[model samples]
Target: MKATDRTPADLLRSALSEDPARPLVTFYDDETGERVELSVATFANWVAKTANLLQGEMSAEPGERVALLLPAHWQTAVWLLACSSVGVVADVGGDPAAADHVVAGPGRFEDGLACSGERIALSLAPLGRRFPTPPAGYADYAVEVPSQGDRFAPYAPVDPEECALIVAGAAYTGAEVVEQARADAPGLDLTGPGSRILSALPYDTWDGLAAGLYAPLAAGGSVVLCRNAGLLDDDALARRIESERVTATAR
Candidate 1:
């Protein structure tokens, strides 16, 4: 971690400054045979827009909780960093009723209605296409976020000691989360920058978060995130590992 890095947002900014052209996240949906790669700049742009949407449109204040009912897709990774940038506590798989806001994918639209606050839905489609018909009482994230400012400046500064994420009923402050990511990186065999780690783990636990997103970012590496990887035949999986140049895996 850089000397100036105290939060995950700082890590992202550092990554962007260091290598904007390098692939930051490579996403694959083996179930759909879809693949998308986002460079550091591109991913950061998405994060900025999403952060703007959360802060301005959703009226999410610093320290507020946002329930994330999504999978381990690239967009989910964007939302995680977006929440961090704006100081909103990202609660993964958290109860909708308890959140100040909710971001849900198509599969969790009905459940997201439990959030009395602002609710947003993602189509999770290829190229982030909007839903055929928008869900009732929910703002379409794909539609709304695009119009949000490409650059974001948080209205309030994020406190590293403040709670930034909640996973599996355990809360982790911003600093602690960064610390955990750095600690996990070596054990996960993340060999510093440029290490391409492929992860098939779901984003519902600290271990999964460390492998699929945080550790790679903290280690100045990148991740190949695969969804429904179990569906891939052994031959196909082997080909993917070889083609993607996977150095390690967290499955």
Candidate 2:
């Protein structure tokens, strides 16, 4: 992380400034044989559009809670940074009824309806395809997010000391999250620049979050996130590690 980096958004910005074309997130769904690669600039653009949608359309105020009922996909990573960019607290697997806004995957669509606040739903399909029938009382994220502005600027500066993430019932401020991610990098074997760590951990806990997303960013590296990794045979996994140039593994 740079000296000026405090919030997770800052880490993203630093990455973008350093190398816009460098791959930041490479996601693989072993069950579906789907693979996607997103560069730093591409990911930041998604975050910007999502942030705009949250701040302008949802009217998410600083410190407001956004329940994220998603998994360890690339879109989930986008929403995490988007929440940070807009200064809202991202509550992973949080109580929907208590949130000011909700973003849920297809499987959790019914559960997210408990939130009275604005709700968004992701199909989580390959290539971010929209659902054939939109879920009732929820904005389709693939439909709405595309129309949002490409640039995002928060109305107020995000306080690094303010709570930014709630995972597994523990709240962490933006600064603390960054510090913890930085600390996790070495142990996860992400000490060198351009380190490519492949992770199959879910995003419900800090360890999963660190290994899959934050630690790679903090270490100026990229990640190969695998979902449904158990479905891949040993030979296929070995080929993937070699093809993806993976330097570390986090399970």
Candidate 3:
């Protein structure tokens, strides 16, 4: 039998061990004309720090729910993995009042307040920089994440069969997500370190999460994530594909 990848973090370990310097996630904002690329080790560092922030700064515990209020950007992906690392269930667009925390982008900062709990805001700026001025009622992820330790050892090992992702109508365990992504990769022609998938899919849905987030990580491939891709012209898209060495696109 083929070895089963147990959890979302398991893929990160393989990617990090295989090629720490390889590009793991490349993010683009067509509307803002912003681009950011992160290698495996760099991405892992961000994950570690964010994981620590979730467990330490936010006081998030295993089995707690966190509503994800961001877009399909790279930072959002980091949060998904961070929650998984700490065994926090990531609720994408789920009810906020029912959650222990809410992570929102600037666009929805006010809307996010409707949910009563710890609020973390992302300026969503290039390089995940801090807001020049912090939001009054929210913790600035950019500022706090950097202060966290680079190395992260989860308080305890996460159970693979536990709920990890919550979406519109369904919830998936960490093992289910990993297994499905591993199964879906070959159909997408993604298999190994050389794969580079440029996905324009919005992350609010399970399909988008699979194509743009989990699949690449599972296959040891990289993702070129695009938000506001509809605004980009054909020439812009072509250039992105070429410059980023994108081997596939979920157009």
Q: List lDDT for all candidates, in order.
A: 0.93, 0.95, 0.88
Name the runs in model 2 displaced over 4 angstroms: none
The full ranking of all candidates by lDDT, starting with the best, is 2, 1, 3
Summarize candidate 3's per-residue lDDT along 164-245 as a digit string, tens digits: 9998769999999999888998877787778999999988898899889899898889899999999988998899899888
Q: 49-161 in candidate 1: lDDT tens per residue?
A: 99999999999999999999999999999999999999999999999999999999978999999999999999898989998788998988888988889899999889999
What's the C-alpha lDDT at position 99 in model 2?
A: 96
- The clash count for each model shown is 0, 0, 0
Tens digits of per-residue lDDT for model 2, 1-251: 59779999999999988888999999999877889999999999999999999999999999999999999999999999999999999999999999999999968999999999999999999999998888999989999999999899999999999999999999999999899999899999998678999999999999999999999999999999999999988998999999999999998
TM-scores, one per candidate: 0.98, 0.99, 0.95
Q: Whole-model lDDT, candidate 3?
A: 0.88
